[model samples]
Target: MYSDDELRPVSALQHFMFCPRRAALIYLEGLWSENRFTAEGRLLHRRVHDARRGEKRPGVRVARGLEIRSYRHGLVGKADVVEFHSSSPGQSPQVTIVEYKRGRPKPALDEPFHVQLCAQALCLEEMLGRGVSDGAIFFGRANRRVEVPLDTALREKTLAAIAALHELIGAGRTPAARYQARCRRCSLLHLCLPKALRPRATAARYLALATQPPAPDDA
Candidate 1:
C-alpha cells in the first residue's frame, strides 16, 4: 500500500510502455515538447476532461472525467469515462472504463493504450470494491470503441507496469534514449532527441561527427 504522496499517475504506465526514456524525460527531467499528434489528442479530450458530469440512459449511467485511484498499486488518474450498466433494479452495475484516443483503431500499435486502460480498470475495481471485467478505447477519428478485456493476463501486466513505474520514480534517474519507429510520433521527440542521445555516444559526439566534414587527406 502506498500513501497519497507516493502514488504515481496511471498515465505513466503508457509512457513507460512506449519508452522508458520518454517516461523519464517527462516525469524525471520535467521536459515536454508538443507536436501535432499530442496537440490533437489534447484537443480531442479537452471537452471530456474539463467537465465532471454524468448522464443516465435507461439502464446505463455515463460518467465523464471520473477520478480513480488504487492504493494497492500506488496508481492515481482519471478515467475519460466510466459506464455503469445496471442489469436489474438492485443488482450491482457492471463497471466499464472508456478512454478517449485521437486516432482510429490500430490494434497492432495499441498495446500501450490497452495497458493504460487496464490500469484504469484496476483502479476502478479497487475503488468501487467490485470486479471490472472489461473496458473500451474510444477512437475519435473513427468515432468508435475498441473493446478490451481486463483478464488476468492484462491485470498481471498492468500490476507489473505499476510496480516498475514506482521503481522508476523512486530511483530518480532517467533512462537513456533509444531510437524506435514510434519515436517519430512522440511529441517529445525534439526534447528527447532519441537519435542524438542513443546509447554508445553522447549528443555532442553525435552532433560533432555528423556536422564535421571528412578531412581533406582522408578522402
Candidate 2:
C-alpha cells in the first residue's frame, strides 16, 4: 500500500493509457499546454465540480463533485457525479458514478474513459464499502450516456494502470515520444516535439545532443 504522499492522481490513468509519454510529460515533468479540446474538457469539469451540493430524488440521491480515493491502489481524484439508487427503504443504495465529457462518444478511442470510470468505481467502493457494479459516462456532444461495467477485467485493467502510473512517476523520466495520428490532438505536441526527435532516442539523449560541445575534427 502506498502512503498518502505517494498517491498519484486517478486522472493519470487516463493520461497513461492515452499515451505514456504524454502522462510522463504532465505528471512527471510538470509540462502542460491548452488547446481547444483540453479547454473544453476543463470547462465541462469546472461546471460539474462547481456544483458542490447533493440533490435528493424520489429513489436516488445525486451528489456532484464527490472526492474519492483508493489507498489500496494509491489513487485519488474526484468524480463528476455519483448517483445512489435505493432499492428498498433501509438497505444501502446501489452506486452509479457519472463522468461528464465534452465530446461525443467514440468507441474506438474511449478505452481511456472507461478505465477512468472504472478507477472511480474502485475508489468509490473503497470509500463507501460497497460494490459498484457499473458506472456511466455522459457525453455532452452526443447528449447521451454510455454505461460501463465495473467487471473483473475492467477492474484488473484499472489496477494495472494505477501500478503503471506509480512506476512511471517513481522513475522520474519522461518517455521518448513516438509521433502518431493522435498526436495532433495532444496539447503537448509542441512541447513534446515528437516529430523533431528521432523515435529511438530518449528525451534526455536529444536534449544532451542539443547542449553537447562540438566534436573534435580529425587531423
Candidate 3:
C-alpha cells in the first residue's frame, strides 16, 4: 500500500517519466544519490520554496511553495510559485501555476516539469472549484515565463500520464533499456550503462549453450 507521503510528491512524476527503474530504485528500494546538477537545482529551489511570504507587484501576487493537491487525479504536490490576480481586494483571485526550471526548453517534452505543473493546476482547480485559466513555465536561463493554457487536450494528456505513472510505479520490475538520443543527456547514464549491459546478456546466452550437454539423437 502506498502511504500518503508516497502518493504526494511531484518528484515522483519526475522519476516515473525519467526511468521506471530509477523511480523504483529510489521510491521502493530506498536508493538515492545526488549529482552536481541535482545539487544545484536543489539550491535554486531552496530559496524559492522556502519563501513563505507573498510578494505583491501591481496586479499580481507571488506565493512560493504553496501546498497543492488534486482529489480528481489523486495527486498532491507543491507549486514552485503561484501567481494570483484579482480585480479588487475582495474579489476571488485568478490563479496561475508558474513552474521554475533551471534549464531552457528541450527538444523533447520535459515530462517531469510539465506533469508537475499539470498536477498543480489540478489541485488549484479542485480547491477553487473553478476552472483554471492558464499556467506558465519559467526558465531561469531565459528569464521568461512561457504561458501555457490549461486546455482540454493538455488536461487529458496529463491525466493519462498520471495513470501511466501509477501503473509503472505499482509494477515492481524495471523496464529494459533501449538507446535513444535522449540517453546522452540522461543523468543516470553512469548508473544505467544500457549499452554496456546489452552485449553482456547476449554473451551470457551464448556461453550457456556452449556448456549444455547434447541431447540423445533419435534414429
Q: TM-score per candidate, in order?
A: 0.89, 0.89, 0.79
Segments of candidate 2 deviating more than 4 angstroms: 199-219
Cα lDDT tens digits for candidate 2, 94-204:
889999989999999999999999998988988888799969999988889999888999889888888888989999999887889998778777677776587576778
Question: In model 3, which range of ten residues has the least summed lDDT?
Answer: 210-219
Regions of candidate 1 where Cα sits further than 4 Å from its true position: 50-52, 199-219
Highest-scoring model, lDDT:
2
Query: Any runs in candidate 3 off by more than 4 Å, and if so which?
Result: 1-6, 88-91, 199-219
Between candidates 1 and 3, the lDDT winner: 1
lDDT of each: 0.84, 0.86, 0.71
Model 3 quality (TM-score)? 0.79
